[model samples]
Structure formats: C-alpha cells, structure tokens
Target chain A: MTNRILYVLALSAGLAVGPAAAETPVTIGMITTLSTKAGYLGEDIRDGFQLAIDQGGGKLGGVPVELVVDDDGRKPEKGKQIAERFIKHDKVKILTGIVFSNVAMAVVPKVVREGVFYISPNAGPSRLAGKGCDENYFNVAWQNDNLHEVVGQYVNDKGFKNVYLLAPNYPAGKDALAGFKRFYKGKIAGEVYTKLGQSDYAAELATLRAAKPDAVFFFLPGGMGINFLKQYAQAGLNETIPVFGPAFSFDERLLKAVGGAAVGVRNGSQWSHDLDNPANKAFVDAFRKVYDRTPTLYASQGYDAAHLIGSALAATGGSLSDMDAFRAALERADFDSVRGKFRFGPNHHPIQDLYIREVIETPEGTITNRIEAKVFTDHADAYASECQM
Target chain B: MLLILEQLMNGLQLGVMLFLMSAGLTLVFGIMQVINLAHGSFYMVGAYTAATVTQLTGSFLLGLLAALPAAAAVGMLVEAVVLRRLYSRDHLDQVLATFGLILFFNELTRMIWGRQPLFMDVPDWLSGTVELFPGAPYPSYRLAVIGMGILVAVFLYLLFTRTRLGMQIRAGASNREMIAALGVNIRFLYTLVFGLGAMLAGLAGVMAGPILAVEAGMGEEILILTFVVIVIGGIGSIRGALIAALLVGMVDTLGRVFLPGLFRLFLPVAEADGIGASLASMSVYILMAAILVWRPRGLFPAQI
Candidate 1:
C-alpha cells in the first residue's frame, strides 16, 4: 500500500514538472490604436501578428508565445498607462505593435530604458531613428520618412517644377514634408499644415487652387485622406492637378472608401500584395484566407515583426535570460521578410527597396495598388548618419 | 480677388451646414430644457444610414429620404426610453445620461458597420462645378447645400409663424408648466419637438456624407461647432442660430485661408505659418467669447 501511494505521488509530480520545463511560453504585450478613426490600422496589424502565431500552432519558430493586446485609442497618455500595466503587472519582457508615432514616442523611450525589448511593427518616427536611437529598440518597419522620400524622387524625375505640400500639423506630418523636400529639387508653391483631424478641406483646397502648382503632394492618412480625395475630386481639381502621397493614404481598405477618386494617383510604399516573392505570396494568400480582406503594408510589417522575433527566439533557444544573445540574434534578422531584401540599418530601421505604386482598379472593379517601378534598391534612411549607435 | 470670393462662398456653405445642425439642437434645449450631448450621435446615425441605403439602392435621393425617418425614429425612441425620465432631473444628470448615450451609439455603429468607413459618392447630377464668377468655379454640390439650408430656413419660418404646433413650441420654450396646464400633451409634444430637431441634424448629415468620410463618431466634430453656433446665436431662437452659424462659419473659413498670409507680411514664413494655423483654429472660440462679453444672455435670448 505504501509503495503504490508513493508511485502515484511521483507520477503526478512528473506531470506538473514535465511541460513547464520543456515549454514556458514567452509573453509579448502589444499596444496599438484599436479605437477611434484609425482603429482599422491597428486591427490589421494585430490580425497579421496573430496570424503568424496561429500558423506556428500557438508558437513562433518552435517556441511558445502568448500575445496580450491592448488598444491605445491614438492617445499618448493612454498608451503610457497600458505600457505601465504590461511592464509591471504582466511582467512582459518584450513589447511590440504601436500604430501612431506620437504614442510610440511616449511609450518606447520609457520602456526601453527599463530594459524591455521593443520591436515596432509600424510608426518609425524620425526622432527614434536618429539621435534617440537605442540598442534595445528594433523597428521592423521602414523609417517614417523612407516612403515619402521615394515620392519626392519620383516627382522630381517626372519633371514637376512646382509642388504644393499638405499634411496634418503633427510630428509625423512634419517628417513627411521634410522627407519629400530632401529629394525633390523643385519650387515649393505652398506648404500648408492643416488641423490634424479636420474633415472639411474646402478652405485649403481653395487656397491650393490659387497656388496652381504643377503637382500636389499630401500625406493625409486614413479618413483624412478619404475626405481630401473625395472633396478634391468633387471640386474638379483632380483632373487638372496630379495627386501624390505615401502608401498610408492608398491602402486597400482606404481605397475602397475613396473609390474612383483614388484611382490614377501615385503613392510610394515599401511592400505590396503583388510583390514577386514566395514568402510574400504565401503571406498575402494566407492573410486573405483568414481575414477575408486584403492586407495593408501595416499588416506586412506586423507579420515581419512576428517572424523576426520568432527567429531570435529560435536562435536563443527561447531563453531570454541572456539579453546580449537575444539582442545579437535580433540584429542578425534571419527571417524571410515579405518585403524581400530586408535588412536593418545601424539605427535599427529597415534598409530595403522602395517602390512607386499607382492606384489601379482591377477588372473586377476593386481598387488596389499595382507596383509601377522600383525607386530605390537597398536604400537606407537619410537619418542613419545622425545615429551614433 | 477671385480667391477671396471663393473663400466667402466656402464660408457661406459651411455656415448653412452649421445652421442645419444647430437649429435642431437649440429647439430641443429651448423647449425641453434637457441637454443632449448625444445630438451628434443622431448626425452620425443619419450619415451611416444614408451611406448604407445609397450603396444598396444606388439612389442618393432614396438614401436621403430613408435617413430622415430613421434618425427621427431613433431620436424619438431615445427620448421616450432614456430621456423621458430625465426631464425633471438636474442639468448635470441630463449631461451624464446623454454622454453615456454617445458611447453607446458609437459602439453600436461600430458593431453594425464595422471599423471601415462607408463610401457615399456625390450624385452625378450635382457633381459638376459652376462658374460662380468670371474666374472662380465652385462645386454645384456645395451650392445645393447652401440652397437646401435656405429652403429649410424658409420652411421653419413659415411653420413658426403660420402653424399652431409652432405656436405651442414657442410657448412651451417659455413656459412648459403653463402649456401643461393648458391641456397640451406635453410628453408627446416634447417627443415631436425632439424628432423634428433630429430630422434637421439628419439633413446636415446626409449633405455632409458625400463630402466627408461617413464613419463612426463623425458627428462629434460638427457637434462642437453647433454648440458654439447656438451659444452665439441665443440658445432657443431659430433666427439667432442662423445668424450665429453664418458668422462662425465665415470667421473660421476666412481665418484659415488668410491668417497665414496676414502674418507673412510681418514675420518669417515658417514661424508665421505655425502661429497663424494655431490662431485660425481658435478664431471661432474668440468670436464666441467676444459676443458673450457684449451680450451675457446671447445675441437673441428667448424672452422669458
């Protein structure tokens, strides 16, 4: 009787210890804007990230992971509070997924200082890419200015003599205009910074008409872009002036909302659904099958962020105790990115090919981006020189 | 000179839209003495309903027709169910209850429509531009909006001056208890007034649908402007709302257009642009404050 009782105790002890020793899932906290007007952006990022983990059978690169997601509602203060909870209560060692640059500025600097690893899926603010660059912070996305710089070069190549610029009055908006001016050697007819969430652009459009630039470049993302494009078309200015912008305004979902107004406009992006790559094809197909909608560039970044972290977890054997090994592994970035030819510059921002995409309506009447030309090959951010790291 | 004329037209167009929104809001506050923060939710409801209906039927007219009744029904239902009990409550209680309604309506739209904004194109008939003058071409759709605002204003004037229901509404705004004592079905009258106010907001929403992105929480932006219009024009007076809406619209539109240019004459371009943009956004609020100092009870306060 004594021998049998001891046997039962040993078996129960083995059952408890066996799984815990073999697989202790790493917890990753994701803070992104999932409410308000920009909620769809964060939804796509979350869906794409979750898709990668789902494909791995609740693991990434054979290492188990648990993703805890929260919405920031596009507020900097709310983002800080969520980050605090994730760090203190959840004991999350790694964090990712912030959609807005302002929220990232509030959260990333503080968390990275406390020794938590941050892999940004989107929102590569210039400040973080330059003098504020940190070793613990890894952006799996291009610098905020990279895509805008491509359009500037394209506009210059097209021989536009005068360009009118418009963007919201915010940090990212300033970065967009600055990036465009860096490559376009043309006369700036007007540089206007409108209210961030202003719905009516009638006043600005009237002023833009008066300036009479050869071309117009704007960086209004999400609903702001939709409002601008629709109103621009209605005002009958679209027929006379060619419109240009970055990929944020031309995403698949936003294109659907803007409809015919977005067609024929050219925008710059780092990745597209039509990119010729095995990894990209698979990711796009799988994303469509799962989400029932075409994935945006934001989704691609989220997928890449997950795969990058997975590769690092695999390299370090799922052990986060040695921060140095994990950091080195992340720096190596031995993952097949959907963008193709992805690498990190010294500032931990993407150095990859950027393409010019024209918004085209497919034969089926769905509007999407078609890659027209590659503007830059193996390009690094202009701010890399400013980074000491 | 052409640019100045076009800017004025833009100001006039924005003014009429604000009038549509504020007329209903002022009437509700004036007659019911209940603060409805969820007034914007009705505007959102109208936009969403119109967008969806237009997409399904391929008719902008039908969409506009459907939105009016839908918004009125919802407003009446809310007034009957949630707001009916709050009539005798303090202003703070009314404010709190209506604020909760805003969140509820926002989430409800998100659930029904999802996060993606619905697209509503300008009808082909109204999509063209008109030569307002020799050099200035303005969108015909904007002109239609201005005309619609004028039509509604005339309709309201005729109703208030010629109709018995309008007389009761004016009387009720001044003395609710007296109307009740005079055998007016006060509850039913309040509901009808609320519905009428909601219909005007719906008209504003339908007009804005093609011009703005029709998404959840779209009403909150215009709601703030509507409040300013009502406060500047005396809170329960339709005449006051019209004048105040136009004034606010002119100040806001002209300020946005010429402020930076005004500053450029004296200051460096970049610094001037920054300051001008900031001040332009504040122009309407400044006007409101200036008006209040001159008339503590608003420009056309309802006679007690």
Candidate 2:
C-alpha cells in the first residue's frame, strides 16, 4: 500500500539523517494537555523543555535530539494513545512532560512496562511515590503534597489558629488539603471543596466571611485561582486576612492575570525566581529572552527534566543500553538543575528543600515571588520508605 | 439572614448577565431560524475588544462603548459571509458550520491575545461596595449590572412593541415567506437582527470582562448556560428569558450555598458534601426537565 510505503520512507528518512550527524540521533516524545482550560500550564512546561533543548544547542548530551510533541487533550485515554504511539511507532526510549497527575498515572504505568523512561516535569501523584514507584519513573517536581505540607508548617509557625480551607473536588485538591492539614496544628473553622472551574466564588466567599477565619488556605489552580483571587480582592477580604496557597496558585503566569490582587500573598515552592543560583539565573534570563515572559515553577520543572535527561545521556554516551547503567546514571542526577543540587530519593522523587516565597511588587513593575525563608530542608516524601523499588 | 440576602444579590447579578447573553441567542434563533452556536464567540470578541481598548485609552467607559459597535460589526460581518449561506441549510448543517466558527474564533483569539487571560480594571466609581442592608454590603459593579439588565430588557420590550423594525422582526419570526413576499427587505432585516443580537452578547461580555477571567473558550462555558436559559424561558420569548435567567441564577447560587448544610443534617459532613455538590450541579438541568415535562414548549411559547 502507498500509505505503508510512505511510512517506511519517513522512518528511513529519519534514520538516514542520524548517521550523518556527529552522534546517533535521540528522539524524546513529550505528551501533555495543550488545549483546554489548563492548556496554559502544559504550554509553560513545553516551552521550558524546549528552552533547555535550545540552550543545549539542540542536542542532549552532545547528540542531536529530535523532540516529538503531542497533545493529550487533558484526557487519560488520549494520553494512553499518545504513549502507545510514542513507544511502539516512534521507538522513543526517553519520555517526559506530563502536566496532570491523572493523565500521568494512566500513561506512566503502561509506558514503563514497555521499558521507556519517564521523567515527569509536573504532577507527582501519590501512588507513583509509594509502593507503586518504578525505577524508570522520575519526578523532577515535588510530590503533590510536599509544598502544601510546608505551607501547613508555615501557617502554624505564623500562629494562625483558625483557618478556612478550600479546594476543588478532585484527587489533587484533596491531596493539597490533606498536605496542608498534615502539619497545621490549628482548628479548621470550615472546609469547602468547590466544583472544579467554578468561577463565581461569591457564595463561598460569603460563607468564608461568616466563618471569619484568621486566614484561608485554598488549592484552586489555573483559571479557578485567577477567579477566586480576583473575587477575593474585590470583596475586600485580602485587606483583612492573609491568603495562603501553593506556588501554582500564585505563580508568575497567574500573578500577571490577577494583577496587584496577588501581591502580599504568600506561597510555598521548591523553586523561586529570586533563588541565588547560577543555573536558575541563566534559565530565568534565557526563558524571558525567548518567551518574553517570566517563567513560572512549571517551566522550572521542565527545564530541570531536560537537564536531568541530558545528564544521564552524557553519562551513558548517548546510549540507554545496559538499562542498569542508565538507571544508575539517572539516579546520580549530576545535572546542573535550575533548582540546584537536585537528587532523587529512594522513590525517584526529589529530596529537596521547600522555600516560602512571598509575592512582592518588584522594582521592575511586575509581581513575582521572592524567597523569604526556608520551610523544610533536605525533605523527602513519607511514601519513599514504603516503595520497595 | 444577611448571608441569604447577599447570596440573593449574587444570584441576581448572575441572572442579569445570563439574560444579556440569552436575550440575544433567543432573538437570533427566533428571527433567523438559525442556531448560532458561535454566539459565545461574540462574547469573547467583545471582551477582547473592550480589554484592548481599555488598555490603549485607559478609560473603562470608552472601552465599554467600543465593545458594542465592534461586536455588532463582527457579528454582522460573520452573518454576511458564512452564516448567510447556511441560513437556508438544515439545522444539522447550521450547527456544524456555527460550531466550526466557535473553534475558528477561539483559535484566532488565542493567536491575537495569547494564552493568558486579559485583566480589565473596574472603573473607580464602580469599584466600591454599596450597602444593600445595614449588615450586607454588595459590590457596586454587580448592582450596576442588575440596573443595566433591567434597562436593556425595557429597551428591548419597547423596541419590539413600538418600532416598525420590531414588527418586521416579529413577523419574520412567525412568517418569513410572507415578509419576503411583502418586499420587507428580508436580507437587511436578518443582518440588522443578527448585529443587534451580537451587540447584546457584546454588552454582556464587556460587563463580564472585569468579573470573569477574559480568556479563550470562555464563550463556550457560558454559552451552555445561555442555551439552558433560552430553552427554559421558551425558544423565542424575551420575557421568558428574563424570568428564567433569574430563576436559574437563584437556584444555582442557593443550591450551592444551602444544599450541603441540608444534606449534613441527614448524613456525615464529608458524605453530605459530596452528595450535595453532585445534586446541586444537577439542579438546573432538573429544573429545565421539570419545566419541559409540564410545558414542552417552555414557560412562554412566544405565541405567533
């Protein structure tokens, strides 16, 4: 058939270009949600990964790397289809860049079984951190609950005894509240789980006003966060009480949308734009120059994923053969991570410090987070001990 | 009691916005016999135009002014180009074509505005909260919205009842062939009607730009609700739209606020929260179904 001939021709064309280059061509396939309400998050991750590859002079470990990007459509089934294609057709050994955990959980198990390595740029579902963790799976981002748990410690340390809790009614949302409750030694006056993407927060805000908590902790991400924060400020609640959240809520991308309303809000993250590190400075600078916008924590994760894979490829000489050698190389994590000094824990998730960042109106006339203090240092997930792998 | 009062105002504000949207959709469907699924595209277009104009001029009022004509022009242009041909086509064809327009508009807006949602500042005069009661303070902007919705509704009522164009539109809806046979300039009438409908949607979008996140695909989210409003209000009745929008708004807001508490009385907190939320989400559709079961043509059938 003509279709089969054309497919063979394209495959051979890709093969023909490899040998002419200095080294064997490496292909990495990126599958992430690129079209929906949360589409911007995936775009940020993809741009960050692309920026790292561009910085590497279009090579990973001194070899030309061909990156294939596919949109998951924010569906787990679509992610599975893309994963199967990347594994079986493209024959990519390294796979990364999943923005949502539910999609990652669906795709990771299937691809890992097929002997592909997945370095998650974002979304660390709990199941992948504990006994379900695989050697082939590495999460460059913090576990889903890590930052919220740190915020819990921060809230308790600030001596807030009464707090109102809110999150979307979903798995990550529950994990976020659970993480916040883990370390906060305070009475929750009220806990509300709003429908995901529920824009009008008037009813909930009115309820929160009635509860009259000293502070409020919410885990509404993306546009939901934008809507909530805007309404919060409009209601004059921001002036009376502090709002606490993870970095996802108060990130640079969202702060731009939420404007001055986001200023003075405190959030926790493993990476801050003001981190005093050479790699971070370079990544931030290069990202702004290329994208003409400030890169958020999601972008930082993507940049780290690229460098992590690059480090492994360099150690293995652009070859992932001798699976043990490659796994050991990745476990070393010797890359110059934009986050600085990153190393995998027993479950392949990062064992790193969580820093409290406060959104400040910077001298540059933009709102961005500044590193205020460290909440947890050399922190590892509680689930790592349960992972036999 | 104060909470209930404020929640009622919130419901009214939402109902007002939905009426702005549904009034236009019902009108277009009634007069043109064309299901304009791209109605939300007009909303997005209006918001973007307002945001951009506001940014350039630094005047919210001027931005609001520009949104009306800009959205109307865009709507008329679309009517003249794509929708004009599809008017005589089957309902399925019209739906498919208009659905394509939604995608085209969404992507085109993305190309122009980028992925980030645009932020518009409320005019300083409208930014403060007004005391509705001694203990309850409602947002002045939302109060302004309620006022605007009422004014628009009155204006629409007058236009339909008092104006020659309004009579033609009514006649066109009930008997298009007779209007055309009478040399009523049916082409001009359709374009004018669509442009007017588009302007109403634009007005809703402009007002909503400050409150809602003005981004791509926003039109689709609110469009579904608008369809529900029109369906419940009657497919072609303006008065029904106003009443049904208010009803849907109150039911949704109050259900979200009080349902969980009612459930908690019968069950534990967590289980009640889950059950309450699922039911609350279904409350609007259930209302629509109940209304239809009793009156299949909706509350007011727009008697010809």
Top of the candidates by DockQ: 1
Estimate TM-scores for all models.
0.96, 0.95
- Compared with the true structure, all predictions reach lDDT values of 0.93, 0.89
B10-116, model 1: which lDDT tens digit per residue? Answer: 99999999999999999998888889999999999999999999999999999999999999999999999999999999999999999999999998999999999
Total backbone collisions, model 2: 0
Q: Clashing residue pairs, candidate 2?
A: none
* Candidate 1: RMSD to truth: 4.2
- TM match of model 1 to true structure: 0.96
TM-score per candidate for chain A alone:
0.94, 0.94
Give the per-residue lDDT digits (tens) of candidate 1, residues A285-373. 99999999999999999999999999999998777767999999999899999998988889888889999999999999899999999
| Tens-digit per-residue lDDT, B107-220, candidate 2 | 898888888888786778888678888766677888898999999999999999999999999999899999999999999999999999999999999998877788888888
How do the residues A190-225 of candidate 2 rate in per-residue lDDT, one tens digit apiece? Answer: 888888778788888888888889999999988888
How much DockQ does model 2 earn?
0.59
State which docking tier applies to candidate 2. medium
